[model samples]
Target: MTPERREEPGRRKALAFTVLVHAGLIAALFLGVQWKRSQPDVVEVELWSSRPTPAMQPAPPPPPPEPEVKPEPKPEPKVEPPPPATPEIAIKEDKKKPEPKKPEPKPEPKPEPKKPEPKPEPKKPEPKPEAKTQPAPDFSEMLKRESSERTARTNAASAQQLANAARAESELRAAADKKGMQDYAAKIRGKVRGNIVLPQSIQGNPEAVFEVIQLPSGEVLSVTLKRSSGNPGLDAAIERAILKSSPLPKPDNPALYQRTLEIRYRPFEE
Candidate 1:
């Protein structure tokens, strides 16, 4: 079938074209009427429908696929043989044969330890709790009390010893009177009281520390020097000092003193 052509479209030109085509058609119709007197009959035209064209064909199918192939198997790994054992040998000798010796392994050296030197055995210290709640007590008062008690005990003992010494002195005086040395001792005492003192280092006499006895009426008897102080000068000086204090001071102890006097001066008395 033939394709329909598109009309050139525009408003002002189509309107002018339509007006011209109508005028021409009207003039042609007038001419046709005039020509109709000279001619015969005229015919009309009719339009019919048209058929469409056939469709195009497609391409043919491709060839078939090829077959697949399988791969070959792999070979196995090989193994090694074990070592042969040593054979035993026979000997025909009188002497014994030695066996093979095995090698000895060297020992590893031991490490020197940085030991803490036993850390002084860690002196098992006291518990922390006991150290905390329980505080140390003051011993000052207790020490002072003990000191006072000790001093009091020492003073009492010293007083008792002094009393004992006084009693002993009394007994000694009585004994001297019985032995008739009291008056002599008294006169010697008066003479020695302030006049003489023995050497400080003198030693060795408890008795017979006397020399001569002089009566109160003024008579010098045999003078004996005993218990020498190991020093002739001191002994002589003591004698001189004693003689210089002669006619001994009268004794205030009347019962202990007498008319007959014994003079005694020992450089080593005490």
Candidate 2:
């Protein structure tokens, strides 16, 4: 079947479903609007009376009008009569007659004069004991001396500490150099020993020592047979092996490099 014919049934189904949904929505809206229109309006009322209520009656007719008050009249003050006036009496002074005057007696003679009193002797003041005074101490000079001594002690302690630290550092450096030299020698010996080929004539375990001279780059300049293993073939084999290891292994620390090295090797010894 063609594509358009296949889609026609689905399209018709969708259209029918949409129509049903719209009709349902419309019916619901219509019912809601009708219900609102049919509902009756509610009324609110407040009950009241035209005349005053018992709780609101006029206030007891103003408490029956207070009684009127009247003031009483005061009595009049009484009057008193004055006492009768006393009569005036006059007093008279008496006059005396003059008598003859009498004469005063003559003055008596004065007594002899008294001798003058002697003046008291003057007193001598006592001398007070003297107090001995001590001289004041020189505090500034004492303080300066103490401060100088303290500073000297501090300087000496600092110097001692510095010397101790320097000595310890030197010892540590020497130990490290020694270890580096040993490691460098060991590596060279191992390389040379690996290249040695033993002869069948070799009877017992033999040891050979070779003195090698090298440059800073580890290039061998010369190899001298310092000691032999007693066997001629073994000695020759050890020399050839030393020559084969021309350029030796270098030290890890450059400061440990040496121009001459004494390497000892054994064929069967570990």
Candidate 3:
């Protein structure tokens, strides 16, 4: 069958459904309209006139009260004290008060008198020609002495520089010797330190100084305590350590070895 014919049933069903829905909506609208109609409508109308209306008048005020009648106050009885008998003793006229004396005007001081002018003395005639002017002294010798002094100062400065150079050289040599001695002393210290054995009772940093006599072969011949530490045990321990460390390490240079060495031992110095 054709498409229109085949859709006829569906179209009819849709139309019928739409009609039923429209009818139901219309019925509901009609019922709502009837209900609104049933309820009475309120109409409000306001009329305006071009001319103004008259205002209301207020009531009038009450009348005033009648005048009051007051009785006159009785006159107070006169109780005058007998007028004091006119002060029988005569009143002397008031003594005239003395007028204050006006201060006298101060006299102006007179100006100081002018001093008399002094007469000038007459000048005496100039002295006649006398001795002739002295001749200027020569400065050549002074100049020569100054030159000599300058030359001497230069020479002295040169000599001082040479002396300073010599002293510097000596100081350098001494410093080198001191450094070598320090190294040798450090080596001996290390050796002795290794041999030292401190007691547990020893506390604080007690220092012991020893005068060590040694041979060039690095043998410690004698150990003499020069300064003893506060603790006798520490001092003894240091002496023993020095002796035990005989044949200590030798310096690189044999000449650096000293016959007597002052050694300061401190157990706390690590």
In the predicted model 1, the residue pairs found to clash are: 184-262, 211-224, 212-263, 213-262, 213-263
RMSD of each: 79.0, 67.1, 57.7
Highest lDDT scorer: 3
Clashes of each: 5, 0, 0
Top-TM-score candidate index: 2
- Candidate 3: where are CA atoms >4 Å away? 1-165
Give the 10-residue window scoring lowest on summed lDDT in candidate 3: 88-97
Q: What is candidate 3's lDDT per residue for 100-168, written digit by digit as tens?
A: 010111111111111111111111111111112123233544454456556555655665555555556
Ranking by lDDT: 3, 2, 1
Candidate 1 root-mean-square deviation in Å: 79.0
Model 3 quality (TM-score)? 0.38
Higher-scoring candidate on lDDT, 1 or 3:
3
For model 2, state the Cα shift of residue 237 in Å.
2.0
TM-score of each: 0.24, 0.44, 0.38
How well is each residue in 127-148 modelled by candidate 2, as lDDT tens digits? Answer: 1111121233346444544555
> In candidate 3, which residue pairs get closer than 3 Å at backbone N, Cα or C atoms, i.e. clash?
none
For model 2, give the 10-residue run with minimal summed lDDT.
Answer: 86-95
